[model samples]
Target: MKVEDFDMFCTLLRQRSGLVLTSDKAYLLESRLMPVARKWTLKSLDELAVAVRSKRDEALLRDITEAMTTNESSFFRDQKPFDQFKQVVLPHLLANRAAKKQIRVWSAACSSGQEAYSLAMLLQEEGARLAGWRIEILGTDLSSEMVNKARAGLYTQFEVQRGLPITHLVKYFKQMGDKWQLNDDIRGKVQYREYNLLSDLTPLGQFDVIFCRNVLIYFDQPTKSKVLEAMAKLLPPDGILYLGGAETVLGITEKFKPMEGQRGLYTLAAK
Candidate 1:
């Protein structure tokens, strides 16, 4: 790709997905977009950029964005977040939301639904404690392909093996030839949608707890601040946000502050 074409591609990525594609990551972009180019019958990334510029085809633009943004996700990824959700967040929600008897969790940038389903499995373990409560898990991602896959609730052996415990695997999944089918009971707990985080989040309503882990690291500071503030608006005073181990709210936004004893756990900053 020419320097100009690469810059245009990077701009396209940022405008469509809020991802900051630096020059150093140019190779990464080319590598990922190659399959996209072939899929659209374009001979080169430069041609792909030309097609995007001239035609501005909605499908083509979406393909380019999704290709760059779609990333790997696994069940119980980075153990501590889930553990904290169960041990810390859940207990607080149980107490605070007792009167409402309903709770909603948003798995932002939820890739292929593993994270949402993981929460479902966790809640399932709660059993009698949440028997009468209405529990909702909304898994949103920029990739429609991933959202549909999440809706399918099927996982290959390698996918299931990543950070998934054998015990939970047996309890929630049934063998279907080479793949495992997540039980309908767990599948039904979560909802999947194709959404852009940079867009207005009001339509999604509010969430009690949000798991937006590992996503903001790709964004530049301004984009990160925008996303974090938008999320803060959706959270209640007691709402919790869980970022990836490598991500943080400090120096990014005043909407949240880290819980002193916790690593990734954050609650709304005091007004």
Candidate 2:
């Protein structure tokens, strides 16, 4: 792509998805959009840029943005977050919300549902304790395709092997021909939606625990702060937020503070 065209493409992506792209990331953008270009029967990335500029098609723009959005996720991506959930966060939430007997967890930017499903499995393990309780696990991604796949609850052998324990796998999944399909009970526990994190989050309602992990690295400082502030509003005083190990609320926003002894865990800051 030409230098001018590359800049335009980057600007479009930022405007649509809040994804920041530097000059060094030009190759990464090209790699992710090549398939989109081919799908639209464009000859080159430059041509794709031209088409986007001339047409300004909403669907096309959405497709390109979704393609560039990273969807890398695993059953438990990192071990510590789940550990914190089971050991600390969930326990605290269960006791506090005992009066209502309801708990809600949001897996923001939940790529293909693994993170959400993993939480469902944990809830399943605690089913006896939560027998009369209402549990809701919501998984949202910017990509509609990913949301659909997540709702389907189907996984390849390779996907199932990633971070999924052998015992849990045997208990929760059924081998459907060559792939594994999560059982209906676990699959029914979570809901998937295609939503942009940069947009209004109020409609999703407040969540007791939110896992918005590994998604802020792509945004600029201003965008990062904006997102963190919005997240703060959705969280109650005691609500927990989990970010990627590389991401932090410090130096970005005052809405959240690190959990005293927990790594990659945060809670709303005191006013």
Which candidate number maximizes lDDT?
A: 1
**What lDDT tens digits, residue by residue, belong to model 1 across residues 162-254?**
999999989999999999999999999999999999999989999999899999998999999999999999999999999989999989999
lDDT of 2 by residue, 31-56 (tens): 99999999999988988988999999
Find the 10 residues in a row with the least total lDDT in model 2. Answer: 71-80
> Over all chains combined, what TM-score does candidate 1 have?
0.98
For candidate 1, the lDDT comes to 0.93
Off by over 4 Å in 2: none
Question: What residue runs in model 1 are displaced by over 4 Å at the alpha carbon?
Answer: none
Q: For model 2, state the Cα shift of residue 179 in Å.
A: 1.2
Worst 10-residue lDDT window for candidate 1 reads 70-79
Model 1 CA RMSD to the hidden true structure, in angstroms: 0.9
